[model samples]
Each structure stands twice: as structure tokens, then as C-alpha cells.
Target: MTDDIRVLVIDDDFRVAGLHRDAVASVPGFTPLEAVHTLDAARQALRAHQPDLLLVDAYLPDGDGIRFVADTERDAFVLSAATDAVTVRRAINAGALAYLAKPFDAVALVDRLRRYARMRNLLGGDAALTQERIDRALSIMAGGAEPATVSRSATEQLILDGLGDDDEASAAEVAERVGISRATAQRHLAALATRGQVEVRLRYGTTGRPEHRYVRVGKR
Candidate 1:
């Protein structure tokens, strides 16, 4: 599994930032480091943590976020309620990878984050890169991208879809969800773990054999 993209949530509203952090954790390839409410704290966090992504808001109690986004070198995405054309243009001009309006769906945000991860993987993971592959990855980030589909059996896809939240699941739980026998589900999940699409860890009991829990591949 790839390293989870560490995220810093910068928003004035504590509740909103907490929600965003939870949303980030629910995504496969993202993990929230911390949430800060003011520009000073954000700057201190940026220096201390050096996160891979910044989910920033346009309004801050200490300072405006427009200049901050424009000047920051890290990858930034704007999630703000400010829907004015000027704010939108400024966010784009400030090099935001994605500008999600307020009240957006968490699923939609996860999709975009997956796209961003795909692009980064294409550029950083591939040893032999090509123009076509680069274009395809960039297209994904540009929102005209194809779905990140894989060739697998229908049952396998169903299991993968069921793990979208990327939470750890036991074989019995997966069997219930996929309408399969526990043995079959465990077999499939173990195979996926071998293929690096899932991760398996043992949970010890007080007085029995350890139980295996599986999670979708990511930094957990």
C-alpha cells in the first residue's frame, strides 16, 4: 500500500474541519494530520508537519486565505462556501487542484482525492513513464478522467466497492455484505491482500486463536 497522504484541514469552523478530517479518513489514500482554525496556527502546522495536502478555507480569523493559497508551495484544495465568481477565479488562480463548494457530498470529495492520488502515483510510482500515461493521469485530475476501473470478477468488484470507506472488516462481515460464504470471502480477501490491494492484521483474543481483520490498502 502507498503512504497515506497526510492532510491539514484549515477552516475557521471547528465542526466543519472535524467533518472534513473524518471525510479524509474515510477515503482510502488520505489521512488527516490535524485541523487548525487560524492562519497563524496553519503556518505553524505547515512548518511542523509539512503535510502532503492542505484542505483550506477562504476565510480565516487571522488573515485572508487567498494570499496564503497563492503563496504556499504545497498542494492545496479549497472547500469554501464563497461561491462568488471572484472567489472562484481567485482560488483557481491560486493553484487549487480542486475547489469544492460548501455542502458538497463526501463521496464526491473522495472521488476527487482518488483522482489526485492516481495522478501522483502515475508520476511518482512509475519507473518508465510515457507521454500517454502522463496525459491520462492529468486528465483524471482535470475532471474529464475515466473511472479508475480494474479488470476483476463481479464478486471481487462488489467486495471492493463495499470497502469504499476502507474500514477494517472481518471475513464474516464481508460474507454477510457480499452474500457469500465466510470461507469464500476470506479466500478472496486473502488473495487481495497478497496482491497488495488489501491489508490483513491479526486481532488477538483473550483465550482463542487470533482473528484476522482486513482493510483496503492504505496507510491505516
Candidate 2:
């Protein structure tokens, strides 16, 4: 790649930052700029290196990574151990591109990094994106670029965004959220399940037949 994406890995833990640096380096179109431990160091490095992206942790000794990232205006994704909804919401509100809870396999992080690269390329083009281009690019971001046979339509993208790989939601719930028919939501969810993009399980209740709930598979 002519223009490799420069990345800085920022975390309070030295070992974790180094591991993330390696993961960022492993991707084809990404370059590891440097890994820093604290928010102060991250700021100095950011000013010095001006990396295109940041692999950030939410907790920093000097300051909050969410505020730092939001202030920086650079592309960022969080690799954090904080699993609370509040933290997740703050990260999202801070404009994090994506968030992964910690203690996860490095492979999962690499997958998201690669997906983000694809996303950057698609949306970062100088020319304005057409409607179809926007839809397809977002679809690829959600479902990934693999399994070329399985296509993700705009409706399916809505389902995936609502279903979010971290939690389980019933078809009706997803339908209501995305404003789609329950049957349509269920069909898309089933398609995603067949692709190993989601997990389907039976949710047993007090006095009814088991209801099928779909959960995203890669949140560990």
C-alpha cells in the first residue's frame, strides 16, 4: 500500500500497549508508530508523530482517553477492559469508531483493525460518496469483507447495527428498533447466523415456548 495508515497504541499498561502495537503492525496496510503508556505521553506522541489512527484505552493516568480522542479529531477505536454500559456510551459519544471490551484474543482486534482500514479507504476518498457507495461501505464494515457470497443490504446493515455483536436481541426487538418487519429482521438475523456473524440461542421463559434470541458472536 502506498499510503499506509499510521497508528499509535495508547494504554496505561506497558505490556498491553506493546501487544496492541504488534497487532496493529500485523495488519497489511497499517504501520505501528509507537506505543505509549499514559495520556501525557500519548499527547506528546500525538503532536510529534501525528498518526492517522489511535488504538486507545479508556483509562489513562493523566486523563480520560475518551476526551482525548474526541479532542484529537483523528480516527480512533477503543481496546479497553471497561465493560460497563456507561463507559461504552461515553466512548461512543466521544466519537470512537469502534469499541472492544478487553481480555479478548488478539485475532479479534486484528479483524476489527483490518475492517477499519477498509472503512477508512471507502469513506476517506476525496470524491464524495454516492448513496450506493455509502450503503455498501457501511455493510462491509459491519459484516466484514469476507464470505463474498453473503451480501448485506442496507436493511441488513440496520439489523446488524441494532443487533451489535455484544448483546442478544429478539427479532421483534430488532424490528422495532430498526423499523423493519419482524419476519424481515429474523430473516436477516438468520442469514447473519448462517455466516457465523451471530449466534442464535433459545431463550426460555416462564410459560411460553422458547423464543429465539440472536447475539453477536465476537464480543469476548
- Candidate 2 Cα errors over 4 Å, as ranges: 144-220
lDDT of 1 by residue, 1-220 (tens): 3478899999999999998888899986588988999999999999999899888999899887867988887788899999999999999898898999998888877877777775665456436755555565667678773334422354465466446444778887665444445787788887888899888889999988999988887635
Error of 1 at 132 (Å): 1.3
Candidate 2 lDDT over residue span 91-197, tens digit each: 88988878989988889888778667655544653766557556545665565433333345765765776666337789987764454457878889999899998
| Candidate 1 C-alpha error for residue 157, in Å | 23
Global lDDT of each candidate: 0.77, 0.78
Top model number, lDDT: 2
Write down the TM-score for model 2.
0.64
Question: TM-score per candidate, in order?
Answer: 0.64, 0.64
- The true-versus-predicted C-alpha distance at residue 145 of model 2, in Å, is 8.8
lDDT (Cα, 0-100) at 156 in candidate 2: 74
